[model samples]
Target: MEFNPGPPLLQSAPRRSFLKFTGLGLAGVALASAGCHIQKETPSGRLDIGEHDLAVLNYAYALEQLEGAFYEKVVAGFYGGASALEKDLLTDIRNDEIAHREWFSDVLVLKKVPRLQFDFSSINFTDRKSVLTTARTFEDLGVSAYNGAGQLLALSPFLNHAGKIVSVEARHAATIRNLLNFGSFADSDVIDANGLDGARTPAQVMALADKYFVTKISVADLPTH
Candidate 1:
């Protein structure tokens, strides 16, 4: 089957969806009155995740968890029967994803974001097309996530780190797309009409991610602007 980079299976959520989904109208109003203060409990049991940092970390952590689980399945299945080149590329991508997953895991462990649980019900591990298509979606989303979250990082180091990851993720996206076709790598669909890639805020990314993740992630504290 030819791989189709269809319109996002899920639509991005606007501000109204956040308020409705999280029931944060009253809390949002309250936070605004208090100079926009929102407190988040971190995984270490001793840290607090304030508005900006916590939200970005949570977003990255969520993506890492998803990618980690996905690559683990891909590598395991390929161990049984996969072509040489496919094996090589998938292995490389899996390693990269593991590195990303570990980076987020360590950061969350330090800040105390609880370990994440994943559900891959939507994926068919036995089918190469399905697996590659899903990988394409995730890699594309990762690039977009970093692009969208770049402005949200208040620290220079974090911003630079995000830039580093985004470049790598864009590479991953292009590779996976090309693997699905001979010349579809980094096509305009992924890049967009402006000659730039797409971006989505935490709320937007989380909304789409929620479909694949069974665990409910609360983004009530994320900022809209």
Candidate 2:
């Protein structure tokens, strides 16, 4: 996969609506869906993130960058049999992810966060199954990534901000799942026995996300306090 430097593609939607949607948050929901649980890690050379809030924010920015890039490529050459609706839907999602990416970048400005390089050569945009499956992986991971980062958030406001983003991510996951196979959204595959969706840890998310990135993710000064 080639690493390209530039802004996120396909963000022409009205920014007001997107911002309003984000501000709305996930109010009045029976089951608040989160990310995959971060399990204990074995021997792996993955990067270790610090306990600092900025580290957590950096983690989020990295994933958003990946997801935004993935959708951009998909919309650029939508899979075979993709309809107008699919194109528009994915484009809107692309815009949202890019919005999320930019939001994190703004937050991390003082920290001097580096733009990440991504790998999408494995995804076959010409095939619907490949594209949808990859979307599912990303959406799931994104939700779980937020969840994993949840406990590390030291401030309520930052936690609230993360909640808004992850809830939207869960919505994106459900949309992709339903598209893959109607009614597959929130099935036994993702939701737990208690009906609440799961969340993952930073290490776990990084492990799962290793395949999508060409640049080795290096985390420095992770907050441990």
Candidate 3:
């Protein structure tokens, strides 16, 4: 995927709209969704990320782990004898994924969030298209996840950080999409008519992401206000 460093689509929104969309002012929706349940920890070895914020953080951590693992595999085999450009681009992306994973891990530690496990059994590592398609889906989902969670964040610093991360994820999404087809980056499916990309709440995102994750996540106790 060729990375295009274009200006973000939401740069021109009115200040109020921008704040609301960026999750600075609105009350966020709770994290509860179908197919997931929350449980309190009993000090067992089993992992338990209690409540909404932790659940969401764990979600992001899981994605970073998946991306990091995928890139590691790609680099290990140097798929199809990747070109110099491919090697450099993939390497940079791998580093970014690693940073993201570590950042989330650090945050979990600071916030007392639980650890997560991933399952990549569905992805075919040997097929380039399969790998890229999965990458596109993951990157796109990560961007949407941050966008949706922005409004839910109570801390200003975290909200701003989410915005920063979302922008980078958008770039990743666009690059992966373009890898599938030239000029397919930021298609209407991702960017709305208002030029702003769409957002998906934690539940909405997890609905899709859960298939790739073996250990289930629960967000039943997350705050809505």
Candidate 4:
């Protein structure tokens, strides 16, 4: 809206080129500054994800589904006074999340994996603090989730798929972070001592995601061990 995005955001990192970007740390931690609620849970929502490829695939799928729905709602009722740039940025991210969701869904379909159901009542679209803060959380979560799921991929080819998508997620993370604070494209919270982006296990991720889901996800059988 009326708030400036601060300095123009640096362009998002290119494919597999995140390492080349020095200050690209995770500064979205500030998202936690805001608070928000849950609407309802869908009794039938289930992940049914198993070991290796299936686990990694569904993990990404679920996260994409969550993010896509999040952005969709954000656009539908954009914060009270959104600016043109703000609207465009959120819409672009929405498109990216939707594309990511479709890519995983297409792949999962071949394996006969069922679609996912998400509930966003937990988010309060009317509040800018709640909105941006939540956006920051999802973008950061998406990037880290991909990083964690990378090494667990079963087949070599799927790594290519993950790689392609993670860079995009990283871009989304950077943009969202910048929107919160001009120079926050990258911050120490998400980067490790080795200057690498941090990773999270399936258990760790599902625990946090369960809060917003209408259905509690079951990743209990995942070989994330």
**Tens digit per residue, CA lDDT, model 4, 82-166:** 8798899999889888877775655554342355567777778987768888998887787788787788775555676578778
By lDDT, the best candidate is 2
* TM-score, every prediction: 0.74, 0.76, 0.73, 0.76
In model 2, which regions exceed 4 Å deviation? 1-51, 219-225
Give model 1's TM-score versus the native structure: 0.74
For model 1, residues 70-175, the per-residue Cα lDDT tens digits are 8888888763356798888888888877766665544443343455667788788888888889999999889888888888766554565567677878888888
RMSD of each: 13.0, 10.0, 8.7, 12.1
- Model 2, residue 114: distance off in Å is 1.4
In the range 102-175, model 2's lDDT, one tens digit per residue, is 76665444352466678788878899999999999999989888877787777565677788788888888998
Candidate 1 ranges beyond 4 A from true positions: 1-50, 79-81
Order the candidates by TM-score, highest first — what do you get? 2, 4, 1, 3
Angstrom error of the Cα, residue 84, model 3: value is: 2.5
